[model samples]
Target: MTVESRRLDGNAAAGRLADVFAFDATVARTRCGGCGTTAPLGAHHVYADAPGMVVRCLVCEAVVLRIVRTPGHTWLDMSGTAALDIPDGDPS
Candidate 1:
């Protein structure tokens, strides 16, 4: 699908990510493995309407991040990102 119709932003994944990350995961920077694009998670497009969360690259329209929350656990996958640079911080 076109990125616009299927994309939101990292803000939409805040709540679900709180349980997994101590800091604002959106602020972290990552490089898209598909197109060698780099941007903060906040700048990436996010899709939350599905059964889980899907973050895609704004430039390449490729999957950059995905999260699935099950009843017992949350599954997070960042395979589409070539590199992730999550700064150290405590947003609490």
Candidate 2:
């Protein structure tokens, strides 16, 4: 007879959650609307229908940019632009 078992500790579980919630760095970028600074944006899990997400400025914590994940690619919508640029690969 043979027995096999698998176990996951708290850190392991947390790591998995982090992996699931992790965002792609290549498709993430935002500009602060309040501070007018450009920097890498943070990924936030909000409602499903939200147009996009607000990226906070590293210096000021202001919303620098908005990114939206669509059917094909991730769109980076600037502060004053109505058009969105679709990046390669799955945004989510």
Q: Write the per-residue lDDT of candidate 1 for residues 43-86, one digit (tens) a residue.
A: 88888888888988989879998899899988999899899888
Task: Give the TM-score comparing model 2 with the true structure, all chains together.
Answer: 0.30
Off by over 4 Å in 2: 1-31, 36-53, 80-92
The 10-residue segment of model 2 with minimum total lDDT is: 1-10
By summed lDDT, the worst window of 10 consecutive residues in model 1 runs over 2-11
* lDDT winner: 1
How high is the CA lDDT of each candidate model?
Answer: 0.85, 0.38
lDDT of 2 at 43: 37
Clashes of 2: 3
Cα miss at 53, model 1 (Å)? 0.8
Q: Write out the backbone clash pairs for model 1.
A: none
